[model samples]
Target: MKVMRILLGYTLLCSQLCFGQSKLHFIVFADTHDRSLGQTNLKTFHDLSSSIGFVNTIATYAGLQPNLLLYEGEKCNPKEIDQLLTTLVVGKDDVIFFYFIGHGWNNRQNNYPSFIFGNAYTDRATLETISRNQYDIYRRLISKQARLTIVIGEACNKERSDSPPVISKREIEIMSPQPYDPLKIKALFRNWSGGFLLSSCQRNQFSYSDLKGGWMSVAWQNTFTELCNDTYKRKVDWQLFLTSVQSKTQKTAEKNEQKQMPQFELSILPFNGSTPVSNIIPKSNTPVSITNAPCPSIDSYVNETALAGIREDLPLLHEMYDEIDSDNAKEYAGAFGLFFQNQRNFYNKLGSMVFYEATGIPDKCRPTFDKNTKWVFDSTNEIYQRISVINKYTSNPNKLVQQARSDLPSIISRLEEILEKFDK
Candidate 1:
C-alpha cells in the first residue's frame, strides 16, 4: 500500500513538471523592399524564401513547427508588425526565435538600431516618429512567461558606399527601425532568463548581397544545414553555430572584395542551461534541399576575377552534363547541358559589358546594358522552366517529351541570334 501511494504521488509530480515545460516557437519577418536599391526587393524576396527554408528545416529536425512565419513585401509597416506579435502567447517555458532581414541603420538621435521595411516611415519622418512604440512589442514578449528569446538581424547598419552602382540608386537610403539596446533588454530579463541578439554586421558596417541573396542569409543557411548533417548528432549550440556563420560570411565577403562580418550578443539566465537543441529537433530520413544543393556562387558572376572563375567552371558544368549522358540520362542531360550552356552563352554574348557591369560602366551605356542583361536573363530562365516541366513528365506517356522537342527549334533560334549578333 505504501509503495502504491508513493508511485501515485510520483506520477502526479511528473505530470505537473511535464505540463509546466515550455515549447519552442518562432517568428520570422523579411522586409525585402524599401526602394533604396533597385534590386533590394528581389534580393529580399530570395532571402525570405531562404529564411523560410532554414526555419522549416530546423523545425522539422526539432519536431516542433513554427508558430508563425510572416514575410512582408512593400506593405509591412510598424503597426502591422506589432499586430502580428500580439497574436502570439509566449510562455515562460517557451523559446522564441525572431529573425529580420533588410536594410538596418543606427539612429544616433534615438541611440538604437532599426530595421527598415517598405513603408517603415515616411522619407521626412524623424526617429521619434518611426521608432515610437515599435520596440514595445519585443518588450512585451520577453516580459511574459517566455524564458529565452533569440533575435537575428541580417541588416546593414549603413548604406554600403562600395556597393555596385547597378544595384542601388545614389539618392535613396533604406534603413531599419532602431533596435532596442540588447544589454538593456537583457538587464530587464536578467533575473528572469536569457536572450540572444545576432546582428549581420558590427556598428558602422554594412551588410552585402549578390544575385543569390545576402551573405548573412547564405551563412546562416549553410551553418544550420551542416549542423543538421553532422554525424555526431550533438546538441545544437548557438555560440558554435554563430561562430561558424561568422567565419563563412567573412570569407565570402573577402572573396567578393567586400568587408562585412556578423556579430552577436548573448545574455541568458545563468541557472540550469536552456534546452539542448537536439531535444527540440527530431531525427529525419529526408535530406534538406537547401543544404544538399546550394545556390551557385553568385559572387563569381559579379567581378573580373570571379568571372574568370565562372569560365573555369564551364568545363565542369559540361562534365556534369556528360556524366548524365554517359548514364543514358538523356532527359536530364538535355536540361543540364542547356542550363549551363545558356549561362555561358549569355555571358560571352555580353562580352566586356559583363566586366563593366560588375565594376562600373559609363553612365551613358549603363541603362542600355542593364536592359540587355535583363532580357538575356529572362530568356535563359526559360530553359530552367523547361527543366521543371521535363522533371514532372513521366516516361510512360511521353507527351511532354514530344512538346519539348517541338519547342526546341524556337529555343535554338533565339539562342542563335546572340551568336549572330556576336558575328556582326
Candidate 2:
C-alpha cells in the first residue's frame, strides 16, 4: 500500500512539472516571376529561388510546416490571395505567418505600396488599382483568423525605373505620386492586435537579391536555424528571433554599401509575460493540411477570454492538485479538508468569471458563448462530483487520494479539448 501510494504521488508530481505550450501555423510564398500575360519584356528574378529554400528550411525547423508554398505561376492576385487566406480557420491561440519575397513598387499616381504577383496585372494602371485597396484587405483577412498575423515583405517599394539600380543610394530625390514612406504602409495595421509587419527596407530604400537569394530571406533563415541549434532544449524566444533577423539583414545591407534598414511593427499582448515558441517535438513531423475547413459563419466569432484564462491557469492548478495529494497518511485528514476548500474556491472563481462573460455577450454572438457556458457548468459539476466521491472514501484515505489522482488527468484532458475549440 505504501509503495503504491508513493507511486501515485510521483505521478501527480510529474504532471505538475510538465510544461504547457502550443504550436503556430506558417505559410510562406514568393512572387519571383514576371509574366505580364506572356509579355517577353518581363524581368524574372533568379534570386527568388533562394527565398523558397529558406522558407522551407525554417518552416521545417520550427515545426510550423507551411500550409501553402505558392511559387512562380501560383495565383497571387489580391482577390486570389485573399480568398486563399480566408479559407483557413484560425484559433485565438494560433498565429499565422505570411512571408512574401518579390518585386514591390509604389503606384505612380498615389505612392501606395504594392507587391507584383505573377501575371496578375499587365499595365501600371491596373497594378495601381490593385495596390490601392489590397493592403487593408490582406491585413483584415489574416487578422480575422488568428490571434496574431505576422507579415514579412522582402521587396522594394520604389519606382519602376528604366534600369534598376546596382546599389541603393542613401538619399534619393522624392518623386510625387509614389508613396516612399514605409511607416505609412505599416500604419494600415495600427488598429489591429497581435499584428507584426516586417518590411525588408524603409520606403525609398531598395532590397537586394543575388545568387545567394534575398538578403532579408537569408538573414531570417539563418536566425531561426541558429536559434534552434543554440536553444537545443529550451523554447525559442519570439522577440529574439525577430531582433536577430533585423540585425543580421541590416549588417548584410551595410556591407553592400546600402542603407536598407528593415522596418517592423508588433502589437501582440502577452498573457503572462513573453511568449515563446516551443521546440518541435517528435509528434510534429506531420504537415498541416492545406485544404481549408468550412469557413466560419457570422455567429462563429466567439470571444476567447475564458478559454485563454483556463489555459493560463491550468499549470498552477496542476501544481496545487499535486501538492495537496502528497500529504502522508498521518496528515491525510487535514490535507483533504484544505484540498476541498481550495478546489471549491478556485473553481468558483473561474466558473463565475466564465458565466459573467457569457451572460454579457452581445446579441449577435450570444449563441457561441451560451453553448460554452453550458459546457463549463457541466464540466465543473463533473469535477465536483468526482472529488465528492473521493472524499466519501474516509475508511481508506490512501485509496481516496489514489482515486482522485487517477481521475484528474481525464478531467484536465476534457477541459483542454474544450479550450481547443476556441482555437479552431
Candidate 3:
C-alpha cells in the first residue's frame, strides 16, 4: 500500500510538469505624445489594448497565462525599452509579441524602417538618439528564444519627414464577444514555433493613419478577431492571416486616396514533439494569392524596358569581374552576373503566361514570381553592400566602379517601381 501511494504521487507530479501551461508576453510601444500623430496613435493603442484583452481571455480559457507590458506617451523611449529587454524573461514554451506604432522612416541602409520616438517639440539630435529600427527590435525579441516571437511595426517607411495631422470622427470599440473554441485557440497559439516580423509599408513608402487608428493596425485587429471567432476552422494558417491583413490594409489606404502595403517575413520550424498532429499548424503551407493583381505597366516595363536595361548593363558588369579583388566584390560580381544572365529568360517565361485581368498571375505562378522578385531584391541589395565596401578600399575608384555605384540606386528604384505594380 505504501509503495503504491508513493508511485501515484510521483505520477501526478510528472503529469503536472509535463502538461504545464505556457505563457504569452505581449509588449506594446506607442509614441502617443507626438503632436502630429497623437490622436491616431492613441486610437491604435486602444484598439490593440482591446485585442490583447481578447487574447488574454482566450488564453485563460485555453489554460495559458497572458501578460501585457505597455509603453505609451512619455514612457515610450529608448531607456524604457532597454530596461524592458534587460529584465524580460521568457520560457521555452512562452510567446513574445512586441508591437510598435509611431512615426518612422527608412534610412536607406536597411529594408526595415527606423522608429522616431521624438515628438514635434524634440530636436533632430534628440530624435536620432531616441530612434530604434524595427529589425533591431525584432532581433532582440527573438534572441530571448521564446517558442514564438512576433514583432510588428506599423509606421511609414519613407524618408524622414513630418506628417500633417489627420482627423476623423470614428470612435474606438472593444472586441465583441464571439463563439470561440478554446481548443482551437490553444492549437493556434501553441502549435507554432518561429519568428514573425511585419512592417506597415515597403521601403520608401508612407504608412497612412487617421484618428480611428493606423490602417494596418485596424486591419490586423479585425482579421485577428475574425480568425478567433471562426469555429469551423480547426487550424490557423499564418500565411492566410498575413494575406488577409495585407489586403484589408491596402483597401483601407486606397479608400483614403493613399497607397500602403504591409510586408512580412515568416520562419516556422517543424514540430517534433509528442503533441497530436491535429493540433499542429505547420508553417505557410497554404498558397496565398495577391489581393490586387499587378498592373499592366509591370508587364510592359519588364518586357520592354527592364530587360533592355539589364542587357545594356551586362557588358559593364562583366568588365567589373576583373576588378574584383575582395570577397565582397566577388560576391557582387557573381550576383550581378547571375541576375543579368537569367533576367531575360525569367521575364520571357512570365511574358508567355496568360495573365487574368482580375488576378494577375495564376495561383500556381504567383509563388514563382514572388520567389524570383525576392531573390532580385536580395541580390540587388547584396550588390549595393559590396559596392560600399569596394568604395572604402579604393579611395580613387575606377570609372566602371563609380558608374556602377551611381546607377545602382536607379536600378533599385526601378525594381521598387516594378514591385509596387505587383500590388504586394
Candidate 4:
C-alpha cells in the first residue's frame, strides 16, 4: 500500500514536473546488495533506485526517456554503475544529481574492503582512488552535446577507523571533451566534472548502517528516497544529506550494515562549508563565483572541520610509496603511484580552477594545472612491473627500499610537505 502511494505520488509529481523544473534528471537503483538478481533483490534495488529523488529528477522532473529506472533488474554489475552515471550526464546543466547508496565486502586479508555490486576487486583502497579515473566517464557523458554538467556521488565510503586511511575527492579534468578511450576504462571511475563526489566515507574507512534490518548502507537508504520525494520537491543539499545519514546510520546500527558502529563522510569540491550550493545553481556564461579553489594543497581544505573529514579519511600523499619499497608490492606500486600522481594532477587542476574562476573562464576552459598530470610511464611502469613480480614471489625481496621508509620522516610530515610543494 505504501509503495503504491509513493508510486502514485511520483506519477503525480511527474505530471507536475512536465512544466516544472527542468534542472535535474536522476536515475537511481538502490538496495543492490547481491551477487545476482533474485526476485527479492530485484524488488529492493528497483525501489531504491527510484524512491530517492534520483528517479524523480530523471523521470518526473527532467522527463527524459530511455532514462532507466533499474538495470538488469538487480543484477548489479560494473556496467550498471556506469549506465546511470552516463545517462545523468546527458542533458545535464546547472542542476545537481546524485547516486547515493551503500554496499559491502569482506577481505580476511584486510578487514572489509568496499564492494561495488559488480566490479573487479581492488585492494582496500579509497573511493577517491577509484573516482580519480571515473571522472573520465562523466567527461564522456557531458561531452555529448550538453551545455553544463554536475555529478553527485553519495556511495558509501568504507574504511576502518583504526586503519586511519579514508577516501578523498580529487580534481579530474579531461583535455578533450569527446570520449577518448572506451577500452581505457581506467578513467571511467574518476569524478572529474569539477563537481562534487560525496561518498559515505573517506579512502579506507567503513560505511555501516542499521535501518530496515541491515540494508547495504541504510543511513542514506532510509531518508534520501523520502526527501527527494518531497512535495516541496526541493533537491536535498549534499551536506544536509550527510549530516542526516550520519545520525540515522548510528541509530540504526543494530539493524543496518549488520554492525554496531557506522562511519560515514560527506566531501565536496569548491565546498564553501555551511550547506553547499544552497539553492544556488551556476548557469552557462553566468560566471561561476569560486573562492580558495585550487587549494594550495589538500590542507587548504583540511582545517578543523575539513580535518574531521580528513582525519577520518586517508592521508593525502602518505602511503603512496608503500608499494615502492616492497619489491613484491612494486609491480602493484604502479597503480598506487598512479593514485598519488593522479592526486597531484588533481591538486594542480584545483589551483587552476581558482585561477580560472578569479579570471574569466579560460578561452577553452582549460585549467592552469593541466601540465602536472603527466606521468613518467617508464619509471612508474618499472615499479608496476616489480609490483607484479612481488605478488608472484613468496616474500618481498626489496628489503633495502622498504627499510629506507623509516628515514622518510613521519608519514604526516611527508604528506604535509607534499601538500606544501604543490602549493608552491
Candidate 5:
C-alpha cells in the first residue's frame, strides 16, 4: 500500500512540474560582428551598455536563464553557435534565438546566401575554440518534428548608407531544402514543425544602431526587452507576444533616444490571435508571419523617413493593411492619414490623459510608456528611432510599406476589431 501511494505521489509531482515549466526556450546573441573592424574599439564593444542591459532585461522578463550567449568576436564561430542545437535536434519544441550587431558577407559572391561571422579578425585558433554551432541551432529548429521556433536578426549584411540604391532582386529565401532523405539530414522542418525569423535590415540594406554611451546595440535590445520582459504574461500566444514586443520596444527605445530598427518573422501555426492578448510564456518550435503593429506603423514611418537611410520596420506594413476587408482598408487609410496630419491637437489630449493616468510624478512615464493604458500614445525618441528602422522596410527602402500618417483614420477603424477584441 505504501509503495502504491509513493508511486502516485511521484507521478503527481512530475505532472505539476511540467505544468509550471514555461513553453518557451531561446538563445540570444548581440553585437556579433568583425570585432576587429570598427570606428569604436574592442573596449567599446565589450562594455555593458544599454544594449547588453536590454538583453539581460529580456532574459529576466522571460524568466529565462540564457543557457549560452555569443557576443561580438568571442563565441562567434558558426560552428560554436550551433553546438547546443545538436542536443536538441530531436526535440520538436519551439525555441527563440536572437542575433544583433554587425554582419559581413561575401558581397561579391553569388553563391549560397550566407553571411560571414563578423569577427573579421583572422585569428583561427581563437575562432576555433569550441562552443555551439549556429548550424545545429538552425537544424534543431527547422526540424518538422521540432515544436516551434523564432529567430530574430538585428544586423544588416552591409551598411544602409553604403547599400546600392536598388533593392536586391532576390527574395529573402532562407527556407531549408525540402525533406529529401530525413534518414540522412534530420534538421529541416517540412516533416514536422513551424517557426519564423525577423531581421532588422534586408538583403541589400544595413542595420545600424547609435550605441548608448558607445556600447552595444540599444534600439534592438530595448524592443526585445519590453516585449519579452515587461509586457509578457503567462498564456499569451506568439503573435500577441510579438505584437507587444514590437510596440513596447519602440516605446523603450524612444525614451532612451536610441535609434535603430528591429524586425522579425513568425510562424502561422504557432501564432495565437482572435482574442485580446493578456499574457505570455516562453515557446518552442519555428517562426511565423507577423500580424499588425502594437501601435500603428504610420507614426513610426513619419519619424523614420526624416532620418535618412536609417529606416526601420514594424513587420510587413502592407500585410497589416491587408488584414481587414477592402472596404475597411480604404476607410482606415483615409482616417488614419488625417489624424496624423493633425497630430499636434491629438498629442495635447493624449498628454493630458497620460498625466491623469499616472496620478504620480511628472517624469515616471512618457506618454507612451504606460503599458497598462493602451489608448494613450507612447512618444519618446528611442521609440521613434526603433520604429523608424522597423518601419523603414530596410530590406526594400524604395518601397513605402507604411500607411502615411495622413491615412490613419481608416486604419484605426480597420484596427477597431482587433483593438476591441484586445479590450475584452
Candidate 6:
C-alpha cells in the first residue's frame, strides 16, 4: 500500500508540472502617453485587454491555463520591454501573443516599424532613447521557441511622415451569447504551431484611427470575434483568418476615404515530421449548415425591426442638421449634443446589423445583402469622418461643423434610398 501511494503521488506531480509548462502567455505592450495619439492608444489598450480576458475565459474552458501581462502607459518604455524579453521564460508547448500599439515610423531600412516609446516626440534625445524596432522584438520572442509566437504591431509605417497613426462593448453582450465550443477554442490556441507577424500598414503608409479606436485594431477584433463565435466551422483555418483580417482592415480604411493595407507573414512549422499545410488549410470550403440556424429570424429582424428603427431615427437626424445649420448658437449647441449621442447609437446598430446579416443570413440573399451592407458601412464611415474632424478641435470647430452639415443631406438621401431597396 505504501509503494502504491508513492507511485500515485509521483504521477499527480508529473501531471501538474506538465500542465504548468504548457500554459499560454499573452503579453500586451502599448505606449498610451503620446501627446497626439494618447486617447486612441488608451482605447486600443482597453479593447485589447477585454479581448485578452475573453481569451483567458476560453482557455480556462478548454482546461488550459493562460497568463497575461500588460505593459502600458508610462510603464511601456524601452527598458522595461528589453528587460522583459531578456528575462522571460517560456515552455516548449507554450503559445505567445505579443501586441504593440502606438506611434511608429519606418526608417526605410527595415520592413517593420520602429515604435516610439517616448511621448516627447520633439525631444530628439528622448525619441532616440525610447524607439525600438519591432523586428528585434519579434526575433527575441521567437528565439524562445514556444509552440507558437504571434507578434502584431499596429501603427503607421510612413517613412519621414508627420502623421501619427493610432472595445468592450457591454462586455459579454458583444461577444457571442451562446455557449463556446471548447474544442474549437483549443484548436485555435493550441493546435497550431508557427511564428506569425502582422503589421497594420505596408511601407510608406499611414495607419488611420478615430476617437473610437484604430481602424486596424477594430478590424482585427471584429474578425477574431466572428471566428470565435463560429462554432460550425469544421476546422480553424489560420490562413483564412489572417486573410479576413487583412481584407476587413482595407475595407474599413477605404470606407473612411483612406488607404491602409495590412500585411502578415505566417509560417506553420511541421508537426511530428509531417507537413503543416494540411493544418493551415481547412479540409473543405463549403459552409456548414448550422443546426437550428437563425437565418429566418435574422431576415425578418433586418427587414422589419432594423430598417424601421433607421427610418424612425432619420427625421431626428435631419432636424438636428437643420438646427446646426441655423444661425443661432444656442440651438446649434443643443443640436450638436443630440447629434453626437444619436450618431453613436446609430453607428453601433448598423455595425451589429451588418454582422448579423453577414453571418446569419442565407446564401441566396448574400449578394443583395453584401451590396446594402457596403453602402451602409461606407455612409456611416463618412459621418464618422465628420464627427472625428469636429472632435479633434485642432482647427476651427465651426467651419468643420458647417462642412459636415453641408454633406449631411446627400448622405441622408442615400440612406433613405437604401432603406427603400431593403423594404422591397
Best by lDDT: 6
* Candidate 4 residue-wise lDDT, 198-221, digit = tens: 344433445432222223334445
Task: Give the per-residue lDDT of model 5 (tens digit) for 1-424.
Answer: 6995675456445533532342334454433334323322232345322355333433332333333344455554556555545554333333344443344321211111133443533332332232222223343455523354555544444421243222122222111222121111111221223565555443444443332312123333333333333233443345554555455444444444543333455544522322111112113221211343243222211221112111221122344444434345445444333322323222233323223213222233335444533442433222333334433433332232342332323333433332333322
Q: Tens digits of per-residue lDDT for model 6 on 194-277?
A: 677888988668877777677778777666667755355656567877887898888877766678898887777634423343
Cα error, residue 7 of model 2, in Å, equals: 22
Which 10-residue span in candidate 6 carries the lowest summed lDDT?
A: 166-175
Provide the RMSD of all predictions against the true structure, rounded to 1 decimal: 21.9, 27.7, 14.9, 13.8, 21.4, 16.5
Candidate 1 error regions (>4 Å): 1-24, 36-52, 85-87, 109-112, 120-128, 131-140, 159-193, 232-236, 269-424
- Write the residue-wise lDDT of candidate 1 on 1-424 in tens digits: 6995675456445533543344556665566565654255456555444554544433333333346556666544566566766777766556677777666564321112457644533442332234322123344555554666777776666422223222312222222223122222222222235565677776556777655566776777666556544242554455667788899888877776668888775555443445433222212111222333443222222333223333434454444433443234555545544553334333333333233224323345446656655755565456445534544443422454454454454444444543343322
The residue-by-residue lDDT of candidate 3 on 293-402, one tens digit each, is 54233342232323333344446555554444443554554554444332433233332221212233455555666655565555455545544443443333343355
Ranking by lDDT: 6, 3, 2, 1, 4, 5
Q: lDDT for every model? A: 0.49, 0.49, 0.62, 0.36, 0.35, 0.64
What range of 10 consecutive residues in model 1 has the weakest lDDT sum?
A: 280-289
lDDT of 2 by residue, 191-285 (tens): 22365567777655677655455667667656645654423344444566678778887888777777767766555544332342221111111
TM-score of 6: 0.56
Residue 239 alpha-carbon offset, candidate 6, angstroms: 1.1
lDDT of model 2 at residue 188?
19
State the lDDT at 22 in candidate 5.
28
TM-score of each: 0.47, 0.44, 0.58, 0.42, 0.36, 0.56
Instruction: Give the winner by TM-score.
Output: 3
Ranking by TM-score: 3, 6, 1, 2, 4, 5
> lDDT score, residue 279, model 5?
18
Clashing pairs in 3: none
